[model samples]
Target: MDVRLARKYTVKLSFEEIRLPPFEDILILGKKCPQGRIGVFRSFDFLVPNEFESYEVEDKSVEAVFINKRVLKKINNEKIIEILQERVFPYVSESEIIKVDFKMTIFYDFIEGEL
Candidate 1:
């Protein structure tokens, strides 16, 4: 029997306003910092696509955020965004965060074996 799973995630975060460098150039995030930052010796490994847009929402608390809605389909790897809340959310500072919300939709397809 084969099982297939499809998952979609929409993660929205609101934080203190900060100006980020434009995507025209590669951003070496956390490579060098004075202190209290993720200043690891190794270069950071995250790719920001040029297609992102900065939005102006009605809420005023948000400064900068990434509103990503993605769909992932796999045979066994069903939990994509669920794991991120553990690995990623820890890096966010409480003082900088205004709101964090997730919208998830899942679909399951079951196949029966033939006699």
Candidate 2:
């Protein structure tokens, strides 16, 4: 006999904190500056089992996509566990995560006339 698995659902990205700059800045030439330049940076992306819309089905199952080992190292297992406990547990039922997938990317700024 063969068993069929349930379909997986897509969920919105959830994070502990989504920090965005409140204001934009303009740089003046020939002026002393404390910082070189201002830009937006993504600090972290926290994922919890409960947050997934399909948590009911995905629970007790491990699925993940990873980017790079460096990025993975940045997020310690302890921190991930803490985040899951604090943010995911309250919403999801008890379940085991057997797999995880990670994705990583690097971005750069561009200027006119420059490749």
Candidate 3:
């Protein structure tokens, strides 16, 4: 007696408009993320050169954080990290890459003349 087995495979397809850099303002990379810091940094450099700044963290969950340099000009780097620690880091995992659309609003006062 002989026995035969048959296998079938199903494929699903989806389309998305690719966005360069992917993240809008910030990208939080977990410690064990599939793509390491150097690779991500290099890609960003090629895609949007000098546009982002990388910060390697010494935390348990998060490995590094990438912020738009423009954002850095408006906000302190340490303060941004502090905000992430409190609001975002708690929900991230070692194997995840989280994209954050960090938005900021600033209010300023102007003086007509200087004394």
lDDT of 1 at 20: 34
lDDT for model 3, please: 0.92
| lDDT of residue 58 for candidate 1 | 24
Query: Per-residue CA lDDT of candidate 3, range 1-115, in tens?
Result: 3344565679999998987987779999999999989989999989999999999998999999999998998998999999999999999999999999889998778858778
**Candidate 3 Cα RMSD after full superposition onto the native fold (Å):** 5.4
Model 2 CA deviation exceeding 4 Å by range: 1-71, 95-115
* lDDT top scorer: 3
* Per-residue alpha-carbon lDDT of candidate 2 for residues 1-115, written as tens digits (9 for 90 to 100): 3345556679899667542222111111111122211211111123221212111112232222112234345455445445544544344322322223333354669756856
Winner on TM-score (2 vs 3)? 3
The TM-score obtained by model 2 is 0.23
Off by over 4 Å in 1: 1-46, 69-103, 107-115
Provide the lDDT at 105 for model 3.
93
| Per-model RMSD to reference | 22.5, 22.7, 5.4
In model 3, the Cα lDDT at residue 92 comes to 97
